[model samples]
Target: MTAPEDLALYVHWPFCVSKCPYCDFNSHVRAEVDQAAWRDALLADLRHEVALLPGRRLRSVFFGGGTPSLMPPATVAAVLDAAVAAWTPAGDLEVTLEANPSSVEAARFADLARVGVNRVSLGMQSLDDDALRFLGRAHDAREGLAALDVAQRVFPRVSFDLIYALPGQAMRAWKAELARALAFGTEHLSLYQLTIEPGTRFATEAAAGRIVIPDGDTAADLFELTRAMTAAAGLPAYETSNHARPGAESRHNLAYWRYRDYAGIGPGAHGRRGRLATTRRRKPENWLTAVSRNGHGIEREDPLDPHTRAVEALLMGLRLTEGIDLDRIARLAGGEAPVDSRAVALLERQGLLARNGAHLRVTDAGALLLDGILGAVVRAQTAVAV
Candidate 1:
C-alpha cells in the first residue's frame, strides 16, 4: 500500500515587481524591501511552527507568490534547509515554486534547482501578444518562450498557465494555443478562463463597460472544448482548472483537494491542519507580529465540522477524473457515506453521475454543473444527517 500522505508546507513570498490588474492574490509592490529581515522572520516562524508539530513527513512544499521566483537563491536555500531540519521529507517530496516567464527570473532557475525546486509553474497567462497586452503581462511571447526553453533545460518538470475565453475568444483560437503549449512537451498545463473577480480592476472596468467578456453559453462551450482537446492529448483535467498527464498531477494541490494537513507560513497564507483552518495576517508587518503570538495569526482560524469536511471532500474529489471513495468519505466524515437518493437519482438520470459499486463519480456533464450538483446533494445529505 502507498504510505500515508499527511503533511505539506507552504511558504508565501508576498512581494511582486508589480501586481496584475486581475490578480487578487496577497501580493504587494514596494520601492525597496528589507530582504534580510523578511527572510529571518520567515525562518523564525517556520521554526516556531515546527516546534508545534515535529517530525511529520512532508509530502510537498509549495512556494506560492506574488512571485517566489524573485526571491534571492540564498533565501530559498535557507528555507529548504530549515524545512528539512524540521520535518522528514517524503522519499520523493514534490517541491514547487511559482514563476513568471521573464529572463531575469529564469537566470536564477539553475540555483533554485540546486536548492531542490524540482517543478516550475510559470505564469504565461496568455500567449497571444494582443491578449498579453490586454492583461498587462510583463513578458512578451518571445521572451516567455525563451524562458520556457531555459526552464525545460533546468527543471525535470515544467508547467505553464494560459487564460482563455477572453472577450472575443473563439474555440479555434484556444485549440491552437493548447496545441502549441502541448508541443513544448510540458507534463502539466493550467488552462484557466478569465474571471472578473470582485475588487479587481477588471471587475471595475467591466462594470463600467470598458471591458466585455464572452457570453455565458460561449464560455461554457470553451470549457467543454478544453476538456475534449486535453483528453485527446492525454493531458486530462485533474482539477477544475488544471490539466496534467498521468503521474504529472500536482502533489501539493492534491494534498489540499484530498483534505490532508499542511502548514502555511508567511503573510496572507492559508492552511488547514487537524480540523483547524488558519489564515495568516494579510499584511507583511501584521503577519510578523502574529507569528510572535504562539505561532498563529491574528486574522482568522476556523475549525471545520465533520459535515463540512464531507462536503469539502466531495467538492474537491469530484473534480478529479477519479471520483470519491465511499469508504474514505465515511472515514473523514465520521459516518457512512450519506449519498442523497433524490439528488443522486436526478443526476444519474440526467447522465451526470456514475456509480461504480460503492463509489459515486461525477460525469462530464456533472462536472459542468459541479457547484449546483454538489449543493443539492450536500443540502439533502446535510439535512438527513442532521
Candidate 2:
C-alpha cells in the first residue's frame, strides 16, 4: 500500500494538432491558443491542488494530453517549477511528458528535457508507413522513427506505443512488427490491441461493417504472443498492456494501477486524493473560465465511501502482475474483503485465480478474462456508511 503523503501529479494539456481516429482521450484541436494564458491558468490550478493537499511529497508528475509536446517549453517549465516548490520532492521524483512522434515535437525534446522532463512516452503508434496512414497519424514511419531516435538521445528514459490487431492484421505481421519494436531497445513499451471505442471514428466504421478487427480468438492469440515475446525480450508485462525492464516501469502510471493518491490539474484530469475523487472541466475554454473564476478547474469533487474505494482498489490493483492483498482491501472497505468468497473458490478451482493466504491475483490464463473475473468477484455493496 502507498503512504498517504506520497503523491503523483497529472497535468493535462488538451490541444492537439489533429485527433487520432481511434482515440477518445480528452484532447482538442484549435486554430489558436494563448500560450501565456494557458501557462498561468495551469499554474493556478496546480496551486489550488497544492493548497488542498499540503504536507505531501510529490513523487511523479505526468504531462499527459491531447498532445503535451505541443505546449511551449516555458509553460512546461513554469508548471514544473511551481509543482516542485509546492511539495517536498521525492528522492526519485519522475517527470514524464507524452509526445507525438513528429519532427516538430521531436525538435522541442531538448528544450523540454532541459526544463525537467526526463522521461517521454512517444506516440509512435505504428512502425509501418501504410499502417500509419490507416491509423490517421500525421507522421510517416520515417518521421516517427526519426523522432524516436531524437527522443532516445534527448530523454533519459523513453517509451513508445504500438497498436496491434488492426483490421486484417496477421499474427506473422504482428510478430515481425513486435520484433522490430523490441529491437529498438527502449526500456519500456506500451503495446495495445486495436479496439473500436465508443464515439471513435473506428466505431462508426465497425457499425457500418466497413472495418473489422481480429476475432476474439485471434486477438487472444495475439495477446499471448505479445506477452511471450516481450517477456523473452527481458521487458516483461508488469501490467496488462505495459512492459518494461526491471525497475523501469512508469512511476506515474504505476501510481494509478497501484491505487495510490494522485492530484490531477488542467482540463479533464482526474485525481484521487485521500477519500475524494476529483475531476476537472473537460473543455479547454470552460476549464480556463473555471480557473479564472475559482483558481481551479475542478468540476467535481466527490467523497468515495469505503466500499467504493475498495472496489476501485481491486479493479485497478488486479491489472498489475503483483496483485492486491485481501487484508488491504478489507482495510479500505472498513469491513470484510470486497470479493465474494464463493467466487474466489470457484475461480481458484478453475485455475483462473490464485491465493496465497491473504494475497490474491489472476493467473496468466485469466488475464484476458480479467473483465469477467472482476464482474464475478467484486460483491455488490449494501452497507450504509457509518
Candidate 3:
C-alpha cells in the first residue's frame, strides 16, 4: 500500500523549440518567453501546493515538458531549491529531467546536473535517419547519438526513448536498431509503438490515406520481439513500455503507476492528493494570468468518490508487473474491489490473468490484450462484492 504522505512532484515546462507531428502534449512554441516571470510563477504555484500539503516527504521530482531542456538552468535550480525547502526529501531522492537529444540542450547537461538533476530521459525517438526525418525530429541520428553520449557522461543515471513500428519499417531493420540501442549501456529504456493520435499532423495524414502503420498481427509480433530482445539484454520491461535493469526503473514514473500521491504544477499539470484531483489552466497566457490574479494557476480541484478512486487505482496499478492487492483496493473503494470476479475467473482460464488470494496480475500473453481485459473486468458498480 502507498503511504499518503509520500509524494512525487511533476513540473511542466510548456515551451518547446518545435512540435512534432505525432505530439499532442501540452507543449507550445513561442518567439520569446519571459524567463524571470515564468520562474516566479512556477515558484508561486509550488508554494500554493506546499501550503496545502504540509509535512509530507518528497520521493521524487520529475521535470517534464514541451521540452524542459529549453528552460534556463537557473529556473530549474530555483524550483528544486524550493521543493527541498518545502518537504522532507528522501535519502535517494530521484530528480529526473526529460530532454530532447539536441546539441544545444546537451551542452547544458552538466549545469543541469549541478542543480539536483541526477537522471535524464533523452528523446531520441529513432536512431534511423529516415525514420527520424519521417518523425519530424529536429536532430539527425548523428546529433542524437552525440547528445546521448553527453547525457551518459553528465548524469549518473540515464535513459533514452525510441519509437518503433513506423510505417514501412522492416522487422529485421528494427531488430538491428534495437540491438544497437541495448549496446548503448544505458540502464533504462522507454520504447513506444508509433500511434496516430487525433488532432495531430499524423492523424490528418492518416485520414487522407497518406500514412499507414503495421497491422495488428505485425504490431503484436514487433512488441514480442522487442520484449524478448530487451530481456535478453538484461533490461526487461517493468511496465508496458518502459524497461530498466534491476533497481534502475524510473522512480518518478513508478510513483504514478503505483497510484501514489503527487503534486503537479505549471500549465496543464494534473495532481492527485488523497481524494482530490487538481488541474492547472492549460493555456500559457491563461495560466500566467490566473497566477497573477489568484496567486495560483489551478483551474479545478474536484473531489473523487471512493468508488472512483478505487477504479483509478486499479486502472493504474494493474499496468505494473507487481499487481495491486484486491484488499487494499477494496479499502480504497470503501467496499469490495471494483472488478468482475466472473470475468477474472474467465480470463484466468484463458491464460490472460492470474489471481492468487488478493493478488491479481495480467500474464505476458494477456499484456497484449490489456485494454480489452480491463474493459471486460472492471465492474460497473462497486457497492457489492462479486
**What TM-score would candidate 1 get against the native?**
0.95
In the predicted model 3, the residue pairs found to clash are none
Q: List pairs with backbone clashes in candidate 2.
A: none
For model 3, the stretches where C-alpha displacement exceeds 4 angstroms are 1-4, 382-386
Total clashes, candidate 1? 0
Across 224-322, the per-residue lDDT of candidate 2 in tens digits comes to 999999999999998889999999999999999889999999999999989999999999999999999999999999999899999999999999998
Clash count, predicted structure 2 = 0
**Tens-place lDDT digits, model 1, residues 1-386:** 55544688999999888878889899988788788877888888787667766668888999998999999888988998899878888889898999999999999999999999999999999889998988888889999999999999999989999999998888899889888888888999999889998888899999999989888789889999999888889998988888999999999999888778888888988877678777888998788777666555537779888777777787778777688887787776777555576888888899888877768888888777777877766644545344
Positional deviation of residue 350's Cα in model 3 after best superposition, in angstroms: 0.8
Candidate order by decreasing lDDT: 2, 3, 1
Better of 1 and 3 by TM-score: 3
Count clashes in each candidate, considering only residues at least 3 apart in sequence or on different chains.
Answer: 0, 0, 0
**Model 1: lowest-lDDT 10 consecutive positions:** 377-386
lDDT of 2: 0.94
Quote model 2's TM-score.
0.98
The root-mean-square deviation over C-alpha atoms between each candidate and the true structure, in angstroms, is: 2.0, 1.7, 1.7
